[model samples]
Target: MRLPGLILIVLATLVPVIWFAPLAGERDAVALFSQYLGASALILMGINQFLATRVAGIETIFGSLDRIYILHKWLGVVALVAMGLHDIIDAEMNGLRGGPLSGIAEDIGEVSLYGLLILILASVITFIPYHLWKWSHRLIGVFFLMGAFHYFFIEKPFSNFEPLGLYISAFCILGIVSYVWMSLLRPMTPRGHVYEVDLVRRVGGLTELVLLPKGRGMKHKPGQFAFLSINDGALGEEHPFTLSGAPAQDRSLRFSIKDLGDYTKRLHKTVEPGMEALVCGPYGHFSMPKGRDPQIWIGAGVGITPFLAFAESLRTADAGPVKLYYCVREQDDVPYAVELENIAEAVPNLELVIVNSAEGIRLTADRIAGDLDGDLSTAHVFFCGPVAMRKALKTDLVLKGMRASRFHFEEFEMRTGIGLRVLAAWLWDRGVYELEKRNSALRQPAE
Candidate 1:
């Protein structure tokens, strides 16, 4: 099942408490509702902590690590909103005398809420340095600990032994355990395999690192990604990058990284051969499908990394009738273009099309269908590009008779900002377009 279904199931499990929990006479409806929201926020915060653990096999349940991270983001957002509302709504109940520790608990709760707000703000502001943002993010668990303490000591209508109380307490335990495991215990344990970098090549904005395992290497399929952490102090943080080469027997790995961020820019300049590295995955579900259906692969800019793995895999594997479109600004911007052309020449079932957008050769749905002789109805479309391009192409392809289910792409952003300004501008543009359309229709003669 998808993440939304799982989230619904979680909320559904809590809904019964509203009816089953014993109440003290007739309470203020708004106050009681706010209390429930507070409870939900705490429960969701617990699940949010669990999701951050990155435990083995958990990605399978959410389809991919990308989706898991997306769910993690949304859960935090909802929990934050609920918590804010609970705080603003004033959930104090009459005749419910405070617990012995209620004063201390209330103070802790206030601190946690404010601390969480500041940390979350740091996370949402994309301009911050990655290391600083990460450090702030780690401190969030401390606030969660404070929140749990507040929940434990705060006075409420239900007794500690009551059903609702017990259920929430179980979640508190889950959150605490998850936090300990992720932030403390997990780091102490060895993870992934150690590899020594054999070569480092820089071309334009791209940096390619070739690594040979010092011990047993990770087993991975084509088009999967891994978390890479170099032992150097400057590059110690683990960052996810796609495996740009096909899996080999000697357990070697290759990563094609673009200098897009602060850490990557530092890596491009500082990383050298013989550096110790840790590789901790083979995650993601963006692999070649098993069926023999015709395929259309679209890659733009550095998004072309995965398709490199896919193309290399075709040497021994039989994937029938694949059309690969490599989109870049110009010929100079295209990485591994000659290699792809050579592969296409050697493999009869594969065809390579280079679309240079700078020269006005955009990869549109019409262009795709025209090249395929309007046989796109049966072709499965795989895309990796800017989010706007993906949305536009997907909409156009579906309108041109391609199945919506056949379109596949990963959510590429590892960290996303709220982009409120962009959203507001888009909404204003949409409103103006609607108004124009209405005016045009009204001016036309009756049919």
Candidate 2:
């Protein structure tokens, strides 16, 4: 979402190559390139560790925590690939002799590479439970430490005091510090505002938590989310949930959590009134748009949580003429449906539309266009839903004269796969499409 952060990552990866090139002397070209890949891998892995810390204000550089995590996931994959290449390409420098500990360091490097591969695979595989995956992910820091040890002790072309060596050494220190802070120090320290559970209401698979501030509560806007961690033993892990109510003077926060994962299911069953919890945010930029321009808000299933906060905030805030679409598979599955309807009634500029797919009703782009007086070019559409639904709707709406820039949604999947199958299928489809287009053009006769 932001350019500078990504630009910095690219610069970090390439600058070392330039710095090391002048000192290459008569080294083997392929072997030296392999060494550069190793340096790039270590640098990228260091950045990954820093991102994992979730430092405050870092999200501003990357847009949101969701996007930050996406970058984090891909960077790890790329780093692993780079490491694999470095290993396979044979980086033994000519006339470079090992020090006393070089043999042990090289062995550690091999172990780190294989350990990282297994851990990263565990992360990519979706069948593993979240807690187990998280634990395995934490083990990455161990391998990183091992790799850093190898970098320090293994015989290389440059001395530790050289520019190239110093640059990489800095990242090694950064990686180690980040890992320690995140895995060791940060957890020992108390973070975020403490709150007591004011209410726990369950409706079907949805669990609503209203948290009352124990001391100073977090300040947040509508459509923001917080990481909530209940103090109960099994439920102590922090999980992100969108705030489902408008910010009030009481400083109470509301979270509408769907029982989608193990942690959430446990929270639904075990959480109760008066339970102590920690709330570590008010994160995200999924707020309502300003100005009097026409706006369309679409929320599918539990994706409606943020829109609930937006709707509640509309009671006082001055804004646009808005059409809110609440899409659900069944009528009974809609959380806060009545509340949303009431808000729509109270807010003169707001309108509510319910699309129940189970009753053979669909929220199609043509239907939306028709409702907006057969023109979609002037309207801004905000959506929160499943990935397939978002992709399809965005494609259709853009084709129906809506500007691509006006279609907005948070790309907020916490655990996404490496997408090997998706990429292969997309490439295959594109090739077939191109071939068909070429054949059609050839048969068109002097077009």
Candidate 3:
């Protein structure tokens, strides 16, 4: 998804090897292979650190933090694979048969490898508890530090490939420094614009947080999201949420958080007025497109939050024709239906479609096309809902003639807590539960 950033990382990892290939000097086969392995691991580690930084430019390229994290997780896995291969290759060749002092350096590398392998696996495999995963994930830089120490003191390659060694050393240092700043320094640092809770409203399974900027408020686009930490982690940890309302003249912001987990479920009662919150973002790229193409929005459950902001901003607008499909399990589950209906009625070219599955009304590509003035290919489609809903609908639309490039969606969940169970459940919901039921209905002989 983030091809440009991925390409840059690849170039950064390989360009050094290409530049220094000539000067690497003649060596035995085992020694050369060992050097290659070490260099690859070092370069990947550097790239891993760079991605972990979560800088604005990377987010811009990746389109959202969710995509950035996907890249980050995959990069870690790739780096781990490279490092594992290097370990295996070197162990088989017995290249580092150094005695005494050099053996200590080799041992350091070995220990670092095992430690990193454990930590990275723990971070990835969702079975582990969230707190444990977070702590172990932070410990990765420590192992990387050890690996750097080993790289400096190791017996091979450094004799002739001193420049390459120094380059890796710089990366290791920078990686560790970046990790420290991101995990430690930034969290501890205070913000210039602190917000106080102005109101807390509970609507169905969602809690709406209204914040009043005390000093310098964040200016953001309608569909952008922000990282909110209430009472400095009193109601659990900091989390990202999409702004539900348009930027107000008073600099007050609104966020709708659904009860997805234990921490979020207690938010309505735990949060009170006058409570101070640290709002860290205004991030994400889920917004209206540049052109005036007709927009087909598919919002499910609380995924309607961004669309709410979009509708609020349409008060005095001249955009293209718009059709919104708001899907919910039941009519009672619909949030902001009244507000959205009012906006749709007032807006000249906007049309609203409410699909309640409980009433036997479902959303499908054929249904959307039937309701539209023209073919589905003529409009741009935006979606924000359960991952399963997005995947199924997107696939169906694309199969029915919509261009893949015309579909867009953003993930609100950061995925720190995602594990095999979560993924399996998601797959089951989108796959068997939805598909099998439809298939069974279609297979009836006469109905």
Candidate 4:
């Protein structure tokens, strides 16, 4: 069975035994069910804590692990809900609950409140966007630990019959506690500006920002990306951008952006020299690591940005025997064309193949595969381009026997104004939403 299917099956089997414990005809039997519920809580909490802490450390490591983290959270919610029934049923079956169940209300309320807090905290941290939720999220780790203590400690005697129950509770507490320590105690450079723009220019609809770092700056492997947030918020709303500038002296950073989105369009119009831009970065697994075989870089249009950086970085050390196959629909679409030529001219190790689609130089991975004499065995291919082009290249490269692990590609950012267009249209359909929010001057508090 699939991982999710297995998880659902395990939860399905465990929930019912806990729910109907009070109907089992024996007081001790119900306590046994409560102990099982406690064990589930511990297991769920431990997994969440362990993954959350690991996610805090690095970028791509956790990016790839996000699916597991999501599953762990869903499991946590299920466990929380199931355990509530276990606790309530156990209390009533033992008659420790008072007068016509009037006393049981307070106990259930206390237990449910703890369970509800866990649900709320987990749901919020998982569902809300980072900008709106991160500040309040740090305490969730504490909440999980505190909730565990409230549970196991209240039913302390369960640990005597179910020794394993105590162990699981301890694991959950430690896991979340460990997450808090890793997230807060790590000596990472606190969220701050990575570079300041020295120049912002518009070439047609594209924007080029010449950046200078305010600090020692970032040292990243080739084929990686940084998240750029141009706001004054501590942790700004950012998008991943491949570093176009070589990491050398002067700390000069270069970024080429298309005027396609609300953010990028505003950047073209408003970005100024000396403006602060927070860059939390160097994320992605696309870097051509050492020991990589004869590789080819397949670039399409503006996706050639990282190849530009890689070329310069490699040129400084006369890096490799790799070829860069770049494709652009028009001659003018080649970003930093002059720099590309300079790098090629200076490095004998580098081969720059500019396929100008304007001249009907229809290039593809299949052609490259055939031309290379079906010897893609030692070649690692990196591509960043239009969806159609990347898809074709991947299909052809794999067909030619290139190893799957050797191919890496990045998707381009969607147009910025598209999101705003959707938002505006949605609000326009609702008079109250528009009048209370964007109908500025007319926007006011509603009764």
TM-score of each prediction: 0.91, 0.93, 0.87, 0.59
Best by TM-score: 2
| Candidate 4 ranges beyond 4 A from true positions | 1-189, 192-194, 203-206, 231-235, 258-262, 329-332, 355-363, 385-392, 409-447
**Candidate order (lDDT):** 2, 1, 3, 4
Candidate 1, 387: how far from true, in Å?
Answer: 0.8
Task: Give candidate 2 regions above 4 Å deviation.
Answer: 331-333, 420-447
TM-score of 2: 0.93
Which runs in model 3 stand beyond 4 Å of their true positions?
A: 23-25, 91-101, 159-161, 331-333, 416-447
- Output the TM-score of candidate 4: 0.59
Alpha carbon lDDT at 36, candidate 2: 90
Give me the displacement of residue 5 in model 2, in angstroms.
Answer: 1.0
Candidate 4 Cα deviation (angstroms), residue 330: 4.8
Query: Which scores greater on TM-score, model 2 or model 3?
Result: 2
lDDT of 3 by residue, 1-447 (tens): 567777777776776666447644544555466567666777777667767776667676654776777777777778788788778775333343333467688889899999988887787786666656777888888888788777767676444245665677777778878878877886788443589999988877789989999887988888888878887455747667889989888888999999876567657668989898878777787888866778899889888899998888877666788888888886564778898999988888788888889899889888877766447786789999888778988898888878898898987556543366777889988887888889989999984
For each candidate, the alpha-carbon lDDT, in order, equals 0.85, 0.89, 0.77, 0.62
Candidate 1 local lDDT, 1-447, one digit each (tens): 376648664764477467544462477777887778878888888878888887788776656887777777777777888889989998898865458998899999999888888887777777788889888899888999998888888877666566787888787788899999988998788588899999999754689999999998888998889999999999988999989889999989999999988899999989999999999988888888877889999999888889988998988887779999998996464678888999999888889999998888889999888877887778889898899999999999998889998999977787777785588789999999999999999999998
Ranking by TM-score: 2, 1, 3, 4
| Per-candidate clash tally | 0, 0, 1, 5
RMSD of each: 4.9, 5.5, 6.2, 10.9
Q: List, residue by residue over 1-447, the lDDT tens digit for candidate 4.
A: 135545543663455355445445655665666655655655566655665553434333333232333445555566566556655666433443223444444454465447555544545343344434444545556656555555544433333224444456556666766766656664253453578878888654468877778887766666666668775433245665777767767656777777655556666767778778777656555666676367788787778878878888876653457788878777565666677889888888788888888989988766788756779877878888776677777787888898887777654532111144456667777878656576665556666
